[model samples]
Target: MIICGTNAGSPRCWMLVNDTVLTDVQGNGQIASASDISPPYPSQKSISLPSDGSLYSAMSSVTGHPGSIRRTFGSQKLLKTENVWLLNPQFAGAAIMPSTLKYKEEIYFFFSELNKTARVDEEPYRARIGRICTVDEGGIKALLADSWTTFMKARVMCGAGNTQQQYNNMKQAVVLTAQDKRAGVLYGLFSNAWGRTVICAYSIEDIDQAFSTSKLKGYSSPFVGSRPGMCVRKNSTTGGHNDIKNLGVIRYHPEIEDVIRPVGVAPLDLPTDDQITHAVADIVLAVNDEHYSVLYLGT
Candidate 1:
């Protein structure tokens, strides 16, 4: 699936299925596209935010690609839809990155906003990430009075106060939430000035209480790691951490057809911090023909 947008045009998303591109029945790309391109069951519509046009135009011109395009059913098609909108009302100057994650019945989107000058200076130039809850069937409604009803405000993180470094250019976020059978928590992997780092944040359900007041803690790894992608699964047969197994960083090898693959094992008990920091790259969760999978987005 692909999502694209520009200042002049509406933001859109497309689905690639069986080599053909499929568009939404209504043709709005933002509303009909899947948040996660890979999965047990790929959804038709997911959450999407508007774009500021400057970056999207540049990306479109360089790649010679439209605002949105995807392969599905052996063909390519452009997605156009207007099912979702940002509730914050203050994101007109923001440029959304290409990474997003779905968790806790909501789609969390990450975006970087540039001020009027288009520079990441101290003048309100920084990355801003936010989340919008999924609206039920009848489309989005208006909020109390003047507020837009469909979208919810997102909680943003800046490398300030407690953390040593600031998160200057955060691009993506992958959220792993514990299921009912296991402990409930949210783990996030994001980029900062130093490099990529893994932080354990509160689950999406607790965002209202955790924002600003809460700080995300880092998880120890066994690789020279940054930009970690994570997923959780139940292993009833195994008993520790409620059988909550953590899939470590993806390993890239020359022989592999795909560039990267997940390092499947439990790393919670690894004693030394040196064991962490092995491989550093951005990871994304995607699905193939058979099952759930993960992919490293960076080289």
Candidate 2:
């Protein structure tokens, strides 16, 4: 397994180890990277590795620079989010999902962004789920050459639409997908400003449809060709005029207009408190040839 953390609170480090290396008294793990750099105190960080063996990481710090999502350790070009994409974000979770098309595979990241400019009575933390195509090769040379071209984010709601009972702070999340990776549910643990916690379940299919159909946040023009976040084969289309235009569209407007509300428009009515700190979910095949989801929440 690979592990990443800070060495002395300065530069980050990474190591690869196994059971033997971890259990031996004198065995030391191999150094993946001694001085991989990142923000200080990455307590709110999420990491995932896709099927193609590429590492994706998102990190944010309370007292450091802005948060960022990055893709690394692959044959493809390096990709990262622009500084403005995330604002005081606290990453909760990340996972990869396969698509029907190989090039359309994507990764989803969960986080809550703090709105520093919010009024005293307004909600400060807004939960969000962001996605990016796994095959994204950055952008054209003149535009977002090092940034993800298919990055899109949508607001996540954990309560009734436009209600005051919404939980705006996302603390943890776990996804349970079917064997085909198409049908699934995303369970998000959310908390309100009053320290109350609740579990909200969202349909993966609904989230996917939102991302695939929602309009760009500020773009009023109807797309005549391929949409902004649609993944296309690189070899089929060069970084030409239309490609560059789409890249610019996503660079300036990564957030979608649609909000991803939880299934049934409300949080789960479980008799739980704020003590829950972690969550895990799995799919169980029943004897009746059906699949069921078993969720475990830990304190």
Choose the strongest candidate by lDDT. Answer: 2
- List the candidate 2 regions with Cα displacement exceeding 4 Å: 12-46, 235-237, 286-289
Q: For each candidate, how many residue pairs have backbone atoms clashing (under 3 Å)?
A: 31, 0
lDDT of 1 at 53: 14
Q: lDDT by residue for model 2 over 1-299, one digit each (tens)?
A: 44455645665444445643432112232222212234434463545554476667777646555767777455576678998888888888887776677887888999999777778887899999989888888777788887888899999999866778889999988987765466689999998887777899999999999999888889998774688877777621367777767777888899999999988999887766656778888887899999788888887
Q: What is the C-alpha RMSD, rounded to one decimal, of candidate 1?
A: 17.8
**Tens-digit lDDT string for candidate 1 (1-299):** 44333313334444455558665423332232231221112121222333321011111001222222111111112221121222111121211212233222333344444334444533333443433222211111221121111122233444433444544333444444343322223333334444544332333444433322232223333323222112112112232232112111111110111111112211122233331222222334446544332322332
Q: What are the RMSDs of all candidates, in order?
A: 17.8, 4.1
Best by TM-score: 2
**How accurate locally, in lDDT, is each candidate?**
0.28, 0.76
Give lDDT: candidate 2, residue 167. Answer: 90
Cα deviation of 45, candidate 1, in Å: 17
Scored against the true structure, residue 26 in model 1 reaches a CA lDDT of 35
* TM-score of each candidate structure, all chains considered together: 0.34, 0.87
